[model samples]
Target chain A: MKIFYELGRYWIFLAGMFTRPENFSIYRKQVMLEMDAIGINSVGIVSLVSIFMGAVITLQTAYNLINPLVPLWAVGLVVRDSIIIEFSPTIIMLVLAGKVGSSIASEIGTMRVTEQIDALEIMGINSTSYLVIPKMLAAIFITPFIVLISMFVGIAGGWVVGELTGVVPSLDYITGLQSEFLPFNVFFAMVKTVVFAFIITTVSSYHGYYTSGGALEVGKSSTRAVVFSSILILIFDYILTQLILI
Target chain B: MIQVQNISKGFYGKLVLKNVTNTFEEGKVNLIIGGSGSGKTVLMKCMVGLYEVDEGAIEYDGRDFSAMTKLERKSIRREIGMLFQGSALFDSMTVEENVMFPLTMLSKMDEEEKRDRANFCLQRVNLDNANNLFPAEISGGMKKRVAIARAIAMKPKYLFCDEPNSGLDPKTSIVIDELIKEITYEFQMTTVINTHDMNSVLMMGDNIIFIYKGEKFWSGSSKDILNSGNEQLENFVFASKVMQDLRRHLKN
Candidate 1:
């Protein structure tokens, strides 16, 4: 019951934020900037992780397909299937929980701890929209872009492993990947990305936005943001997968 | 004008402020003086809607703040400005950005207008040349100046200061007090300051409300404070040796 009340209050706060034109105006510019900070700027870490993920998927698939003359093309098919269906988008956000989610938390949490949030209240500004909405929009709009990049890089990483280990010929590997690919799988991944983005960004911002006390409390808020958002991301990943594919 | 009427707040079933009611009028520094844990700060916060009141209501020009919707309350909040004890400037932002923040967030003014207004406010607070400096690089006094500049950037109708004289030297305290008073007069703002400093009470206390154990024990100006004939008021007014000497000089 208390949780529902909290959610209801959050909705009211958000509603109040959007109802004002001046406050919503701040979001337009701030969101674009935050998208670059939390989303585009995460390219290096996402790419590096995607490379490893692809290599690992190829290795696991090769071991499974190695039984008594199973075709190498089948191994390529499995790698593409797993990468498209699950690995790239979901794991990337889990990694983002550490990088982007924590950054939002600490930044906002410190603002709260230091009374900057109160300062905003006195200035007649919507601190939630000024601080949270920009980051929220950034997370929702930019995650799809990041996930798209991750998928491409991860698939490329698999290709590297398949060729180097001679698990599959390059031409046949590429063909198998293309043949097994379903357009709807990519669409589903994008949908999941949006949902996950909303959950992670909103939860992380919420933790930071309401932070109280001193410096220690800000640190705790950041940690809570990453841990809670990451766990929820995994849980929702399964639920979405079941809903989409089953 | 802000009229706090019989406002009380409790936390975890423990009463913190018991029926605090006072009027902080426009263009005057209204000081809420009390010892630590006496609920001065909490009472001021209750007036601003930062904390909810358990009983009674706060009125801004007779509009009951507690009965208003969150959006309506927020609209009132936008017309209010605050300077926190810690200065509370954003560490990541430059002084210019910190001052410009409220205008950027709240005003429909163009960037140039915002920049011009921010610069003008910084200049008003004698921080014109320090616009590029970060809060960490500035002195405590300068940080307070930055906070004042930020607070006034929006030209709020009400200004609240919590511990405005804290952590500063006697000289800087007076300087900040004078600045607050000057701005209060210039803007015709309803200024409410919470302080424990007897010096501040005498110096900036155009209107003083003394809270003793969460109730208004004394309501008078800085002048009447020394002669209120209330023993507790006398003890508090003469707590400082300097004040005692001054009181003695006044008597002589």
Candidate 2:
């Protein structure tokens, strides 16, 4: 019953955020700012994690395939598909759920505790739309691009590791990357990235918007934002895969 | 003028404002005074439409505010400005941007006009040479003054302030109180302030309401306060030794 109550409130919060903005130009400017904060600021961590994860995936895949009959190009196939299908979209989002999710929550939670949200409301502004919509739109607009970067960087990392460790020849690895490549796989990854982006921004925003206490409560809301967003991302990852892949 | 009529508000089945009724007049400093958790804040919030009353209605210059829709309220809200306890300036914005925020969001004024209005407001608050500085870079008194400038930036008809002197030195508190009083008369705004500051009440409270444990206990001008014969009001108003001595000195 409590969960149902929270779910209902969450839907209402989302509904409130979709109302017509008081000023379109101000909102447009805010959207640009949010894009910088949510997307541009995140490139470094996303790239670093993607590169390392890709290298590890390649090495592990090479060691697993020991059969004499199996072609070495299969290692490249595994690296490319694994990175594109799961690691880049799902795992990278989980990492961002910690970095970006907590940030959105804490910033908003601080605003809530300090009466800044009240100040907005009293000024006849739609606080929910003004604060959250830009963040949601920015995440939806930019996460796919982030995932695309992760896919390219991850593949490149795998190629570098393969060449340096002698796991597979460059020619065979390239062949494997091109083997049985499905365009639908990229589309599927993009679809999941968009959905996960919504979840992370909205869920974290909900936690922060309803925050009622001081600094201690703000910290707790940040933790909840990350935890809940990560959990939802994993859940949706499974759901999207089942619906799209199966 | 703002009229709160028989409004009651509750939280989790416990009433925070019990049948609170009052009229805050225009062109005067109307102060709401009470001890901590006495529901003064709740009463002010309810008047401003931040909290819905469980019973009764709030009217702004005879318009039923409590019955209005959210869309219908925006026009009234645009005519209202508020100063919060924490000043509540946007942390990311500079002082000039903070004061210009309302005009930027709601008015058709061009950038030059907006900057002019912001600078005029900042100057009115006696805050000069600090346009580019962020809220974090200012002192407590300067922050409150900046908040006042922002509050008046829209040239609002009604002003609500919640504990404007909560964390200030006595000198700064007196300065804020005088600023609020001057603005109220100059703008002809129906200003409502919530505070327990005795100096503010005695100095600028043209109209005052005393709330005790979620009930309106007394209402009068500051001059009538020492002889109001309300025990709870006396206890709260004279809680400090300085106030009590001042009361004694006044009686003599």
DockQ of each: 0.58, 0.90
> Which sections of candidate 2 miss by over 4 Å?
none
Model 2, chain B: what is the TM-score? 0.99
Q: What DockQ would you assign to candidate 1? A: 0.58
- Which model scores highest in TM-score? 2
**lDDT, model 2, position B1:** 93
Query: Which CAPRI category fits model 2?
Result: high
Q: After superposition, how far is residue B10 of candidate 2 from its true place, in Å?
A: 1.0
TM-score for candidate 2, please give it: 0.99
Give one digit per residue, the lDDT tens place, for model 2 in B1-252.
999999999999999999988999999899999999999999999988899889999999999999998878999999999999999999999999999999998899999999999999999999999999999999999999999999999999999999999999999999999999999999899999999988899999999999999999999999999899999999999988988999999999
Clashes of 1: 1
